[model samples]
Target chain A: MAAPESGDGNNGAARMVTLISSDNTRFEVEAAAASLSQTLQLTILDGGGGGGDGIPLPNVDSATLSKVLEYCIKHAPAAANGGAPNATAVDRAELERFDNEFVNIDQSVLYSLIMAAHNLEIEGLQSLVAKKVADMIKGKSPMEIRRTLGFPDPTPEEQAEMNAHMLEYGWAYE
Target chain B: MAELLRQEAVEKVAEIEAQDSEGVHQEDRLSELPDDILMCILDRLAVLRDVARTSVLSKRWRHVVGLLTEITLSAADFESPVNGSKPTFDVVVQSNMDMVKAVTSILAHTSRRTIELLSLRFYLRDESIDIFRSVDHTMQNREVVKASFAVFPEMRDMVCTDDDMVIYGRRFLSFFYNYPRVFGGLKFLYISCVRLGKFDIANIFSTSIELEYLCLNNCDCGIRSLLQIEHPQLMGLKIICCAFEKVELNWLPKLQLWTYDSWMNSEDRYPLSFGYVPQPCNLRLINTGTTLHKTIKLSDFLDNAIIRQLNLDFQSGSVGDLKTRK
Candidate 1:
């Protein structure tokens, strides 16, 4: 494990790192922003992913990497402040607005984002996407949740089992 | 640029739906996710029953629901069936029995995991002992950070019968006294409608070192005794509609908020007293009775403490009476 960063003293001299997605697309991001991912933070602290050498993320696609980077950059400053005790109400509200808008994507993209966030071990992005998926499945029945997640329709045997369980625990389905 | 991005996302979803309609390939991507991610989604559900229902989705979800760390069980989740209009006495009893069985099953399954929050609210009856024992046994080895156990006995003839109330109270007192270890990790506790004596209350405050919030509503304390609450980590205390001769706060170093809301008919002016609250506090007093002496007593108490905010609501007396008394 890498030692945690001490403070934001070297904010102006923050280094930049390159990330190579699985499809061979190169993107440059600040070291502070990319460090939001625990996996990337350890490698970057060990003097890795510097000039001419980019971290390869074979599990994440180009589209999902950009979305994940967008979240990391937006949240990097607050993360550096260590929760920002002196943050004004307006500042906190603005970050909350950004989070709410960030997760408002299509179901397929949201699924991909959940995977990328998990693979990178980014805490905030993982929680945001999980909460979005949970909200999508919140008050719906089992069939509704299955359909919303794009699972194929239940087979005859599976449907019979669901009917029996629904009959047993009727309150949950209601 | 945002519009173009939205259009692309919408088209991607449309493509997935188009592929989903064809019967060639079918994938349960949600179920195929890692256990930790699925557990994250399961933990966000507000009700435990909803989590239990996920088992019917597929075989993979059966074991995932058992990994949740929070459990909330309520009486409304197990209401009895009605016969034409009203449920018979036997039906009600059977419903309570079924609820106890359900709770026992859940506890037996989740006994190995560390529970962060466990809330159980049910009407007290003969079957309540089983429910309480199941909870105690399950939480014995687990670290439950927050726990609430409330028992509201059913009222007969528009009044809560004293015999039933005493039975429920004694049950609660014995449960806590027998298993003092359960209180060692609680951070928030909300208890209502249970009878507690001086020893029971003191035992809880002394054992629960992490207790930060305590709410006692419609409780019966021992008669003619001062209910002294002395806890080191207690931050907020609220007492509503509870009967006691007096309440003395002692040694609560971190006490920041204290609220007492009730109608007092006591002759003693000072029914509540502060002993060693050094921090700036937010105090709220809502007395509905027209006792001028009580108002004067509260004013005197306020004169001694460092009150950051005071919210006082009296029904019968005016502020002028309090001023004149002062």
Candidate 2:
């Protein structure tokens, strides 16, 4: 098991691990960054993704794996500090800017990232994507949310069910 | 054999192309996400009403709205004549009933989980006693960490009226006395325009151990006895337009801010006194009457207390005597 090191100073010399996507693409990342994913953290601690053996994520495609890694690497330092009390305003602002731009992608890509984040159990990434989807759905009606998410037109039965539900909780619509 | 393989590959490509054209692969991804992720999305909605509205999205969402941990029920949400007209007495009564029904319905349907925060704001009338009882019933079994109960009459200014004020005050005290368990485990409490006597206040302090912030606005219960607030965990206290004879701050070590706003006709000679507030505190006094006797000095009120900031805004002529105490 790769035990967590002591002391607060996170300088260069951090351990690295290799992650393999479903497409068999291998990418090397800092162990600390990849450990943001709770699922990978345990495996990495078990010395599974150390040296020759790479962690295989069969559910994540190459394109989605890269994006997930991008978020983890950026958030790794702040997360390492345990919400670093000494973190300056500029550092937090820069991270906020990165997060805002990170989720800007096509709808299909967003869904792919959501799936990967959920599967990986990355807390920050899951919340970020969820918040983005919530923003898209806020103040939108049921049909609008479906349309925004690229859902096909509901069948007549589904439409009737939705209408009945809406009528029941009509005050919520108001 | 090579020709046959090429033909099969071409047919597969055409099938993929046809599926792409139809967009069938883009199935409701939002609903397809796991329950926990959808819950995360639902939790981000600021208002619980919006969260409830999501139930109509699909059959899967019908029960997800029940997962919200915070519920805020406001009487205004049920107000009729939605176009900003004055609500009649009948309308107000109807809205109060509807508000109670809505809260009960939501609580009944929601998953049995500890609510993080539950706020109820409504007008207190004789008819609303049942509503309060229903609310108490709903809250008794659940764990509510922070709760606020605000009762205001239909007319905003009617809070200061004597008869109406006393009626509301009596109701408020009786409700707390009857069902103290409904307000248990609250960290933040704000009561406005409710009458409270010494025992009522004592009951509140004794029941709510985790109380951090308490605001009593325009309450008429402190007229007879000295308002003694002796809470160990209370951090901030605001008393506005209350007719208290004297407010004695007793054993509140964590209190940081104290604001007392009095009416112009208030005759209480010493409105406030600090006994054991050790924290650096800011005391703000606004619109205090100008009836200080000639022998009383402003410094006498200070009593050599260590206050970080003291802001005294008195009636016009009252400043003449205070100028010498600087």
Candidate 3:
């Protein structure tokens, strides 16, 4: 059995740091905990930022990373648990409840989760957050949509282009 | 809860619209990413319509449907033709042909870096249909077995028609073996409600090695082996509305879920005979007593395999598809 790459920094037990972005703030986290992101997972594995080193995630901030860590800590096994129990009905329901509660933040936090989950490669988090984002897109007018997404007022050309598509898809305009 | 969900939905809609107007450009954003990311995104999409419509997003999305290695569209989907009059059916058929043309063009464009999924549902013969031969001939000859094609055979489900039921020849069945080889790696094949002979289906089943799940809905090939299925990596098998006189259940070595919903209301109770049962299948759902009876015959052979769970929802409409509470 190979030793996990984190304890005592031996037998590839080397540690590293992950810099997350939340409110433009950064916090360094353990490499193993941070490895949960697929984007970062490969970079870390490729030795870009292993051995207790620093890897800056300029996109993620401290607040969102803190929330991501909470979710990952609950879900990430030591790789010893062999990838989160195969999702039995009860466990699935429990996880659902946890997810429902976890995403209960303002639109700002939800957006951060989406980008962070994408960057980190937390598949479950990505799905949950993507679904959360997709859910928000449902049943809203154009003005309401513009307001919720925090997009600045669209220029005339941008508005025309956007309207053309929204009308074409008939999801947003109608 | 519903109101909260609705309100949240309204708020989220507003957000996506705002984002679409600003941060995201009108051109391809995520679609331009590598095929792997595209596949991941497609995996989350529930139906084939979502895949078809992805192309409407931008040029990069133009060929995403073909890039999909495995595509499944419910025969019940709206794009599926509904029975109607000659002109109406012709118009619908033309429109359907157009959609298929568009999809196939997409398939041609993508060349399927990963895989290609093509599924079609045609309206059955009705009194309103034109009762012609050229269209029927074209429908009978062309096929969409593989993901990509050149001499692209027009695809049409063959069945008996009221006006011209004379030319119900078996020539169309020969094309089964010629299923487009381009999609040799296609992971799933689902053909429902079409009347295909059992032997032809067996030939088709025997040929595709990459198929992971095979479903035959309402299509009867007589009493024979529905799946001489040698899909070693196959995981799921669903057969509904298919009538098999005496179908053998052999060759599924690694199947997880095998569901046969042929709800027959007969006093015989045990209508089917099992020759060799595929064991190791963990979840078996039996609503019809006849199928259970057939399964029971293989008890000795299946003894080595222990099913972790057996779901027998046998009631009056025991074989009913539990799609809704009603």
Candidate 4:
């Protein structure tokens, strides 16, 4: 595939890519934003997601894909600047606010986002979701953690196993 | 056509949900995640106790904890409560031993994993535990890329005697000698409230080949003994309230930032002499000592090295007649 012309336009006419979600939804976004995904970056760099042929992601549903793209589009500029060493405090603070708000979602959506971020190999998104999950698990006991993660009621066998594990490793809770 | 497409998509989602309902525990989404993803979640639980507490969550979580790549254990996490009173010496030693036991067990649990970061912060009071040996065992050939240690004494700096300094220094050196590979691969080292000999500090530089940052606080070699430092990879150095005659920066090619907070000497010339620092652009010199009555000329203090940023703070004393020549 022929690469796009260098510096095609001065009016910020960036190249675009289309991604097809598992639910057959089309998302047209800037190529730089889509490249935040290490998985998509190689494909896009090889001129794979150009023009009408969209990159099909079978693992990510349309909702989760939309959320992941929102994060990528917000963070692509900073990522392009090599972590934006020169980024103003105001700009960095704005992005931090966006990230804190973006991961504030329902439990099911959070899990889906985690899986999507992992499948796409998006480093920033992956860490963000992981940090959120970790915070939920921090300072929580075993039962609290189970409830926080929406784990179903334990069966008698599982309860016995949990009891045995707790009795065995009880020193950590101190 | 779009309406028909939406209908089919809704039906497919409903079908999947129906199939998931037939499973025994499909709602446990986290348990359903792959092992690597769970490890990522647990890795952010920086405190070792929190990471360990995840073991009782489920069998999958216990397995994931075994596969964690980063592990941080600190004695402060297990500090015994003193109820607003100063802790007894016995209490401190007991807590340190408790932490040591926990660290030993956890290190054994995750011995098989290829740990990328292993950090430890502990008081140098329990010599019987041999934390150095346990850490060396866990880190050997495991490709541990970054390791840091913050060693502290049980006594405060003001109360520490020369004998205490020598004892701590000896223990630290012996540990260093015993675990050469561990020291060689260390990325950061912070030692406080200990007196290191001139040769001991020199040996650290030679052995800790990969150390990029070092902080020495309330420590010294001897009374006004000249300390010469040379490191090929160290980028940042901080000497806070350290008692040294003159710290000579003999050769640090990659040094970028240096901070010397306080010294005891009242010499007319600057206590720090830069020899071959080529990359440093930021220099901070702070002192609250009465030795600041003397004048300091930046041109002579900098010794021909180009600096872009300089900060001088002499709290409660006048840094008399400061001069900076181009």
Strongest candidate by lDDT: 4
Report the alpha-carbon TM-score of model 4 versus the true structure: 0.72
Q: What CAPRI grade goes to candidate 2?
A: incorrect
Where does model 3 exceed 4 Å of error? A1-32, A38-55, A59-64, A73-95, A101-115, A134-174, B1-39, B63-66, B79-102, B105-108, B116-171, B174-326
In candidate 1, position A112 carries an lDDT of: 75
Q: Given candidate 3, what's the lDDT at residue A146?
A: 50
User: What is the C-alpha lDDT profile of model 1 across A90-115, one tens digit per residue?
Assistant: 88999999999999887777777877
Candidates 1 onward: DockQ, in order: 0.16, 0.21, 0.04, 0.23
Distance from true location, Cα of B229 in model 3, Å: 12
What is candidate 3's CA lDDT for residue B33? Answer: 43
* Model 4 / residue B17 / CA error / Å: 15
- What TM-score goes with each of the models? 0.70, 0.75, 0.49, 0.72
User: By descending TM-score, how would the candidates be arranged?
Assistant: 2, 4, 1, 3
Candidate with the larger lDDT of 2 and 3: 2
Question: Per-prediction RMSD in angstroms?
Answer: 8.7, 8.9, 12.8, 7.1
The local distance difference test score of each candidate is 0.71, 0.71, 0.48, 0.77
Give candidate 1's fnat, 2 decimals.
0.31
Model 4: per-residue Cα lDDT over A61-165, one tens digit each: 788889999998899878777786979999999999999999899877888888778777788999999999999989998888788877877889989998887
